[model samples]
Target: MFVSKRTFSTYRALFHENPLGLPRHKPAPTIPRAHRGLPKKMPIAGVKNVVVVASGKGGVGKSTTAVNIALAAAGLKRRVGILDADIFGPSVPKLMNLKGEPELTEKGDRLIPLTNYGVKCMSMGFLVDQDAPVVWRGLMVMKALQQLLHQVDWGQLDLLVIDMPPGTGDVQLTISQQIVVDGAVIISTPQDIALIDAVKGVNMFKKVNVPILGMVQNMSLFICPNCQHESHIFGHDGAARMAEEFNVPLLGQVPLHADICTLSDSGKPIVISQPDSPFSNYYRSITQNMLNRLQEIK
Candidate 1:
């Protein structure tokens, strides 16, 4: 309810009689359509077919897998873009060998994403110094994410890969709740601790009604080139077992390839540099499975 003009004079006269530094009240500011609370994570918008690559925990080659899969999608002649939403540790810029900051186009306020290996890429590393620590609060992180989503002109893309932070907490919720994600890919190491966390991640997406594309097994095997023998370092088919138990598809398994880590960390994805490598073939197969799954869903 608003005060009428006739009543405004009465309140002003009353405040003047008191003369105790009390001023007449005015109308309140605009109220939003939705009530907002203090969120540990911020919701974002303006993305199409956002595919979140999530894991239960960290240090499981999640980021590397995301990069490779993104490249694989691009290989199909589809327009693809990747958003490095990992605030704590952003490795996309380095993995794709993208250098320099994103160029601001003069026409629209669209941020021109840097390209490497035929895929558009964006990362927090591109905004700040490489060695600088991102000591930002939730709101700050939210603002940054919002800018990345809206400010960047991604153009028309078939899929946008979001490499979410490794956890089921605030950052994860912020991305899940705010963005219209098509599906999620859970990456897990073949171990007890990682699988436990991976299950939690899968459930989190389920609660929010996001479809599980499948679970990918990383570091499932290690084949030494010297002997050309395969060894189960983390145990075989752990991810496949978990997927069956959870009633989700086991998308594919990736071996613990030394070259994948070495090439990605150095900013040259193995798919682009060594297209004939076995690791690249695994990722390519996973991409095809995802396509088939999408068709089934439709």
Candidate 2:
């Protein structure tokens, strides 16, 4: 009756080895020979869908959206994971409220992901000091990313949401070429400058043949708490217009709210911290729409 949550989770992990909740553990289907040579997408052992949340540049709330989306999907009873691929500025550890180096498996070959809020997480932030700077060259960065991607024992996850570094860079290219990403979600504010970078992101993904799941217009609107007046602080419908022009679906919009910022800073994403709130609903709806689209595509 007084079981600690960690103990219970460990018990569950041991007893419930079926991380995907499948009837029986089976190997994933092989990639056909015809498709094998196409950019050589390497499938993660136990992950089915790999969704990358990306932005054209930094400071657009991309990591925040990625964390909330992973939490929201986990709330729907799916085994979810998040990989913070931003080596220079990893935020998943802070956003997920996890720290320290992850534990090794019994064989001591792979890293076990740290868990929080029912979502397993991995990031370079856990391996180094928070204040330390990552000044590695591109080759070193790619090696680190490869370890994070392939050396983690992620178990059986329905979806692995990657919080990608901003811009079309080495890490992004490495992931696109090495991982069989199911789809990508682009995040951008409504400002013209942000959208301009967002366009570059869309083009990059398109060039790599990664399906654009949709675009999320973050900080789309702001509501005055006192007068209930609405304002387009960053300008309005820019993401929607971009989505339409580029033939990508406009997944959803997240309002600029004080609570969103506070909760995120506190390592409690709004989706889990205030599930009943309107802001949580925005994230949940986007998750649902994304699930629906994945289903349709399959």
Candidate 3:
């Protein structure tokens, strides 16, 4: 479904009026008790659906896609939140234009999630100094992932989009085994190298029994802004063929647009920055398709 201009105007006005830096609320610490061993899956306290956005490798615009999806879901009036599961390289804070350490709830135990563009967000980037490197071993990463998954006060959200770290490693396994993921969306470019890794991601999720919602082919094409000519910089229909071979749906293809990158780097993702643009429409359509798939699964 396309977002109407009136709706965009309303959203823009609401965002400008509300602003960021929401007041923190006091609440009792709500951390769950530790289990003896990892159970099959643990559900988040208030989140109804935990949708993880993953990529086989890094630098495939996975984080960008995840941020846009979360924002798009918010634009659709769904109660949405985003969790940055990329412990080693969390990008949600920058993409959402949020920074600084999260304030503790009035109870002093629960962490309050920061808000931007009307979407609640939690990220490791907020916890540590942005310049500091996240030099941690496998076990430490797992522990951090556990806390990020269960500790944040996400409130009551219809959907919590998790920006997972690239690859199918300990973090992925821990999340799939410990947290109850409703489904996962794979992001990849329309290149053979990226698709190879994307396949590994698909296989990894399948092994853990996580439902693959679909695949998003990002950077599929580049259009000259001035000339308005379209070019398939990366091979076209690669993701489509891969989807058919894997029996997964091709959610949508996002063209390579300079505005998408510039706006994202400036901390105003294209979805919210240029809601009326064709690029924004592509993201909205992809989000709608994912929502439809979710409904079907339910």
Clashing pairs in model 2, backbone N/Cα/C closer than 3 A: none
lDDT against the true structure, each candidate = 0.76, 0.84, 0.83
Task: Please say which candidate is ahead in TM-score: 1 or 3.
Answer: 3
In candidate 3, position 137 carries an lDDT of 69
How do these models rank on TM-score, best leading? Answer: 3, 2, 1
Candidate 3 residue spans exceeding 4 A from truth = 1-38
What would the per-residue lDDT of candidate 3 be over residues 1-298, giving only the tens digit for each residue? Answer: 2221121122223322221112223221222445655565779889989999999899999999999999999999999999998887889989999987776554433457889999999987887778878787665565556667766778899999999998888789888888889899999999999999999999999999999999999999988888878999888878888999999989999999889999999999999999999999999999999999998988
Given candidate 2, what's the lDDT at residue 144?
65
How well does model 2 score by local distance difference test? Answer: 0.84
lDDT of 1 by residue, 84-187 (tens): 98876898988888767665544423456788877888887776668978786766666556556555657778888989888898677766765567889999
TM-scores for every predicted model: 0.83, 0.87, 0.87
Q: What's model 2's lDDT at 157? A: 98
Per-model clash counts, in order, read 0, 0, 1
